[model samples]
Target: MMTSIESTPFKRLDAEGRLLKPAHKAETRRPGRFGFRGEIALTIDPPVTLEAAFATAEDGDAGLSFLAGSLSSYKQLPALVEALGAEVKADGKYFIYVSDLDRASRYQINMGGVPLYVLPIDDTSVYNELIDFLYLDKTKMKKFDTAEKLDVIADGAAKYDQAYEAISYEEGLKRL
Candidate 1:
């Protein structure tokens, strides 16, 4: 025996017991209730990586998701670069590296097309050391000792370049 008018559109009330603005059907949607920004960000793509790896092999640069240690574990190199840039912003422990990527900062060390890798100090020191190897100018054309290692180095290098470009280090840190 109730009319439609009696049914209030406001499903919830305000603190003062007043009718609150009704939510639009669209606004109430939950496309991905558990979605995370970190999970769905623009990252280094694989195809681009393959292409980059072959194209920039001389420089050993590519951006590919890879493991810090085992092949099973993987991480987006771009995200690592972003995190490194953030850390550099918080603490100057690796200011020179971050500054190079930061177009606005001083004391920036332009790689002049050299590859870089800004990864966490993970357990795989070997991997980190290998990446450092790829950064060397002499071995760039040396066909990279290991295929897997080469792929990772290429990815890391790509990230290094990207990270450097995104950040604008505070002026006064550039080296002559």
Candidate 2:
């Protein structure tokens, strides 16, 4: 005769015998243009980790969808939103994250039909970081035109690297 060992409720052991906690269900937002939709949790923390930032971009079926720039450039977000007549909802799918709240700022933009979560990093480090993260060849980057470079960066980021914490568009502006 054998007796069954009752495990803790709502908890399970992984292959390595480590206890696994239940996954938290993030709040979902409504669909956006171009069939964009997914869970978007509100995060007050600034994105200090690449994983957090990249997770936002990975939401929905589109995979990685983001653009990055400096705080000065992020200032244009409101005007762009106004031009599009799109309201920035607190729980909206459009999320942005910055490296530093006091200095860095970021935003989101719907270019053509794709929703891009724009991130803000130090202007001085943007190019260097991109080059390193993408493992981009300087000679190739130079040879490529402006549009081509943008494509390369987008493709590379989508493939590799990912952020810290994310906040709403309005919240980001207020911090700025």
- Which one is best on lDDT? 2
Taking the tens digit of each residue's C-alpha lDDT, what string does model 1 give over 34-122? 10000111123431110011101111112112212111111233333442221112111121122122233322222222223332223
Q: How far is candidate 1 from the true structure (C-alpha RMSD, Å)?
A: 20.8
TM-score of each: 0.19, 0.36
Q: Which stretch of 10 consecutive residues in model 1 shows the poorest summed lDDT?
A: 32-41
